[model samples]
Target chain A: MDKTINQKAWFLVLPVFAVVAFSAILPLMTVVNYSMQDTFGNNQFFWNGVGWFKELLDPSTDLGGRFLASLGRNLLFSAIILAIEVPLGIVVALSMPREGWTVAVCLVILALPLLIPWNVVGTIWQIFGRPDIGLLGYTLNTLGIDYNYVSNEFDAWATVIVMDVWHWTSLVALLCYAGLKSIPDAYYQAAQIDGASRWAVFKAIQLPKMNRVLLIAVLLRFMDSFMIYTEPFVVTGGGPGNSTTFVSIELVKIALGQFDLGKAAALSLVYNLIILIVCWVFYTVMTNAGVERPAKKGGA
Target chain B: MARIDLVDLAHSYGGNAAPPESFALKPVTMTWRQGGAYALLGPSGCGKTTLLNLISGIVTPSRGKILFDGADITPLSTQKRNIAQVFQFPVIYDTMTVGQNLAFPLKNRGVPKAEVDARVKQIADLLDLTPYLGRKATRLTADAKQKISLGRGLVRSDVAAVLFDEPLTVIDPELKWQLRSKLKALHRELDLTMIYVTHDQTEALTFADTVVVMHDGRVVQSGTPAELFDKPAHTFVGYFIGSPGMNIVPAAVSGHEARVDGHTIGLHRNYGVLPAGTKIEIGVRPEFLHVAAPASGLLSAMIERIDDLGRARFARVRVGDEKFSARMPPGFSVPDNMVGLVFDPAHVHVYADSRLVEGVA
Candidate 1:
């Protein structure tokens, strides 16, 4: 039998469509338009038709080489942060106090780093790592460690990586904590009765329970770390022989500093595409291989 | 299999108004015989779960010692106690296959792989879960998952006692009886000294050899199903263990007689004396109240209502200001006025102050 249709439901959906168009779709279309065309100073345009794409894809080209090098750097940064933060976050979440006012206090303290403005966090770290007056730098120098983020490439990379970890690991920890909290008491009791050791309990019960949230943490961390710009931009200003210049910083340099709109638009589109592809791959692979977390709240 | 002995067990969550009376599990000493199936039957919040947890060592008792096979195991953890527990909801390792969940306890104790695999196969076969052993536990239906949980308990050869806390609560109604019978069969085959905790009286009665009926955090009575039905030690047990339970009425007793609303009934045993404010009552099961013709019986009552329960019939009869029900056998037709309900003197359990008077017939 044919069912009745309510075409008027489209009216209810119109505002969301309009909002998305203004917020995302329209700007994206403009970028797409810019990516395939050439423009002069005074409202003059001509079809360049994939010329920038050709240049960006060719590694022999300076633009292509810059993009590739920075992409590698961004990939390495994401890998390192993920390796450090995910396990560290799980440990922190597991050790978190399960009851009392102390949980609230600990949560507030953990959230403090995330609450700070990106630029302010950068500024604070810049001062914090100053060799002359800063406590950390002075202490390190006094201990004969020769630490200077301004001139040393390794120091700059280390400081930037440490800063990002400090700034963002709480998000991972908070996600994991929520997952851990959702596991019912019955599972623990059952595990206890099953004579499970601590490691076995963690492996069998706690880790599987946290799989979905852990996936979320990985995806968010990968996406955010891939496009990271604001904090490193303030702290080292992508300095010390471009040791900390990630792909996002490279895109900004081409678009704003060199005033190369066509190449920059292509770069942005390519960057977005890479993120989308990686996220999709991450999602499918993780869901296929990972433990099934019961979507419905409570019970088997 | 090991006998479980609880010596003066008491648990108080505290933060309550006071102690002893306010405790979640009242102080009591009881022993569960080896190879016997026992049920801790009580209403929700009557501390059945608490008692089960204490036995499993999941929750330490606030006071008292627990012994397994005469060895003090109160201070031991659940692992050392060698107890297996299935929770109200299925507690399965979501990442594991049914086979792996069954093998988990043995593997944890470092049992050899061959033995673990053999035991897993045996339990899976017993639970009719052999075909699905390779499937992920998370994908099974509620009853199947519950069966896998039970299978995990059964797979272990040395479990002191396997405890179930309303393990069938999540099962579908149609499968409930099938799973219950399966559990009973498994119990018989293993003779593992199981203790099943449930609020459903049918579950308690049908599954276990002995039922410990609890009320208000205290064990009101412990007996076989027939004994509990025929001779309840307290009014609470009388009212809790049977269908429609025992009709408990407020009455007064003096000498060898009992009075229900100024109507005197002959008592089977003598009451030599009575204290001034002592309250008394008589409990007779609906099954024991015989419907007789008005003129042939001692008291007459007007019929209030009749329920046709297919093979059996029951009529509600008004006795004085109170209403009492009597069960009629199959094919027994009801009279408009179910005038006389002969309360069986032999079957009636007399209570004074909510407890069985010693020597009550």
Candidate 2:
């Protein structure tokens, strides 16, 4: 068969390329340019190739020290929140009403947190956790536990973690619920007929059915938590000696707070690269999990 | 293996206070012999799956008792029933390998590891799944997955019975034949009491020693395939069992004779008295009724069309206001629109109110 080569296809792709250049590529290129150069006041610029990157990576340098500290805190925050949310989400999803008007009511309650704006969630928790006038802080203080998010590092961390959990766990629960709902009734019946216990059914049937959605939930949660800035900034303002300042917050402090655009741009590039790498790994794992191996030779 | 019996078993999804018309399964009192292969044959919504679920203890009957080997098991949970059931779609553990999927039932009941392995191996071999034992079950084709479902059902030797609810519905048409025959061979080799539920007549007839035909929510007829074909006990069975189904047309049946469209047709037996005000109908299978030249037979018919079905030819004919299907001879061509239908008197059956009426010889 003779195949026709259609060069017109390239012309059709020009508009899409133009859109990407304007929306994504141009801004990213500007950041890349700033990352590699130095600029002083009044739009003064000078070539300083790799200088900002070098300072950003070396721990002895001020920029590197802040970047590494915030990166570590971000990683720890992500780990803790994931540890608390995933299983809790699964439990909530499992307990969701299977039918009736109650299902709608439960779903609405679960979604209440996610529907709230991120800054608004931070503001609510900020007032709600105040020792002077807030319900949670006043109750905790009355119970004889020392609690003050404003001045205590431990309290700030605890308040921020709890706030993130309250705001985001519903997303994970909703995803897992969709996965659970896709499972056919036959699996549960078959499991019962097989004399399987409740735990066995969860392990064998429910868990396997929810694998794909769980992976997506984990990936989304990880990325969102790693890049968290607005909520904690409003609640803690990276207080108690920079304890709650995540990588994104630290980058913003350098770029906007200190007016060190070159250093901030360098930090932004590295942070974006890390997210891209992790996302790539997750995508590869998900796609690989779905691929079937070719059948072995000499088999019926 | 155990003989499973249902004593007045019935179910209504609407609960105990619901009226009889709301019953999903009408009361059924029947005993399934040990090691016998029985097929519940019916169209959709005919209570086949409901009955299967009742036997498997998936759905509790609203009334009556179920016994396994003379022990009441109606109140028992599905886990306590000791019966295996395959659903319409294959229910397999996606994370498990084929070997593990087959071994799951045995493993759950705390069977010895070595025995579990042996039983899994045996079932895999029987289903020609030996080659895929190490492969993940989720990666297999639909038919292979269905085989895995069947394997899980058959893994335990002491199960009272195995119930299949249209297990081959997801299989490809060509593969359906192979899988069906495989199930038949497994039934014979294992000597297990198997109750297969299907709407397809071919699957039921070819796989079962006895076929129980159901209609509405009731078992209308239960007999061997040959008996169901030769003497259908109910009009539903007569209409449901055949290829073109039996040619059923309204008629006036009297002693040794039936009148259709003011023409008399002979009957082999005497239906002395039919119930008053009941709709009387005579049924004869297409195989027993042949198309003949005009005025050559007892009743005249107008030939509407001739359908050549590769294996045989059947003529769609109309007599008065009723339509019928009759077999056409290989060399016979329509001489005219008007023709005669020759019915074998022995194959003629009389039905009153859709219930077959046995006649005296």
Best by DockQ: 1
lDDT of 1 by residue, B1-361 (tens): 7888999998888833456788999998999998889999999999999899889988888899998889999999888887888888998998887778888988888999878888888888899998777777888888898998898878887888889999999999889999999989999898798999999999999999999998999999999999999889999888888777788888777666777866677777776566667677788899888676676535677787887777667788788887887886565665467567777777776788898875433
Using Cα atoms with residue i matched to residue i, what is each candidate's TM-score against the true structure? Answer: 0.95, 0.94
Best model number under lDDT: 2
Compose the digit string of candidate 1's lDDT tens values, residues A173-270: 99999999999998888888888999999999999989999999999999999999998899888888788899999999998998778889999999
Shift in Å, residue B344, candidate 1: 1.9
**What TM-score would chain B of candidate 1 score versus the native chain B?**
0.94
Misplaced by over 4 Å in model 1 are: A3-14, A39-46, A291-300, B15-17, B254-256, B274-276, B329-338
What is candidate 2's CA lDDT for residue A13?
100
Residue A133, candidate 2: C-alpha displacement in angstroms: 0.9
Scanning candidate 2 chain A in windows of ten residues, the lowest lDDT window is A291-300
Worst 10 residues of 2 chain B by lDDT: B291-300
True contacts kept of each: 0.57, 0.55
For residue B1, what is the lDDT in candidate 1?
A: 79
